[model samples]
Target: MYVRTSEVRGDPARLDEGLRLIREEIYPAVTAMDGCAGMSVLFDRNICRVVATTSWRSEDAMWASTETVRALRESAERALGGTGGSEVHQWEVAVAHHDHPVPDGAHARLTWMSCKPALIDRAVDLFRMVALPQIQEFDGFCGTTLMVDRGAGRIVGTAAVESRGAIESSRDAAAMIRERFSTELDATVDGVEEMEVAFAHLHVPEMV
Candidate 1:
């Protein structure tokens, strides 16, 4: 699967309005498009940051919808009183595991990493074998997905859990695993953020 993520910084007070527009306007429009697989929104209300992700069946489909997606994003940003320009990233869904359907009140921990292109496959293997198992040991673990930009050596790993408490309790362990994995892969840890899964729906089948 191919995914497009738009990171926007906006006014915290206008978050509700922005979410409303995304659900009422953007969701329907994107889902109706050809080859659309899914769409999800992650929000960090405290920082007024929103990460909107749209998944496509193929790279071509994602690229083809660029203009339309850009316009929709701009509209949402305007409605949300976004200050800085958004940062957009394109990625391949490298690994996906569905432990359970994402529940209401789910929260996610997003970790960003940068590595050498040559180590991409090894990184995936390490995540599947080591990182994933360690994370699953935590309470309220829902599922995890790893998205990568191979050419750019960029990776975004998202771990979804039941609540903020689950995330907090698992933080130390998760950080340790993340640090080890990064060191083994010679990756640089960009940053980590906590977010609430405001919305998520997938039209595509599970990858594994």
Candidate 2:
């Protein structure tokens, strides 16, 4: 599977409006497009960031719909009162797993990292084999997704849980796992943010 992420950092006060547009406008429009497999949105009020992700069945399918999504993406940024356009990225879905169907009111922690290009595959292996099992064992665990940009050596991962409190309690342990991964994989942890899973409608099959 492939994925595209459209991110906007905007005014915190307009979160609700942004989310409304995402859930009502962008979701339906994008999901209806050719070859779309799934779509999800992540919102963090503290940083005023919203990330919209759409998964595709193939590389061609993902690129084919880019232009059409451009307009809707800009509209989302405008709704958020964002000054500029969205930060966009294309990725390959490296790993995807869920304990159960996602429930309402789930929260997620997103981790961004970059490593040596050659280590990308190794990193994915470590994550899927070692890190993922530990993650699933956490109380309130829901699901996780890992996406990679091979050319850029960049990776973005999501760990969804039942609520904010669950994320808070798992902070230290999560940090330990993250630090270990970076050390082993020679990757730099770029940014980490906790966000609300505004919406998730996935059709991408589980990889693990």
Best by lDDT: 1
Ten residues in a row with the worst lDDT in model 1? 199-208
lDDT of 1 by residue, 121-162 (tens): 888899989988888887899888888999999999999899
Per residue, candidate 2 scores C-alpha lDDT tens digits across 131-208 of: 898889777999898899998999988898988888888888789889999999989999998888888886668987
Residue-level lDDT for 85 in candidate 2: 59
Clashes of each: 0, 0
Q: What is the TM-score of each candidate against the true structure?
A: 0.97, 0.97
Prediction 1 global C-alpha lDDT = 0.89
**Residue runs of model 2 more than 4 Å from their true location after superposition:** none
Compared with the true structure, all predictions reach lDDT values of 0.89, 0.89
Model 2: weakest 10-residue lDDT segment is 199-208
In candidate 1 the C-alpha lDDT for residue 26 amounts to 95
In model 1, the runs with Cα more than 4 Å from the true position are none
Model 2 lDDT, residue 195, Cα: 87
Model 2 clashing residue pairs (backbone): none
Candidate 1: residue 107 Cα off by (Å): 0.5
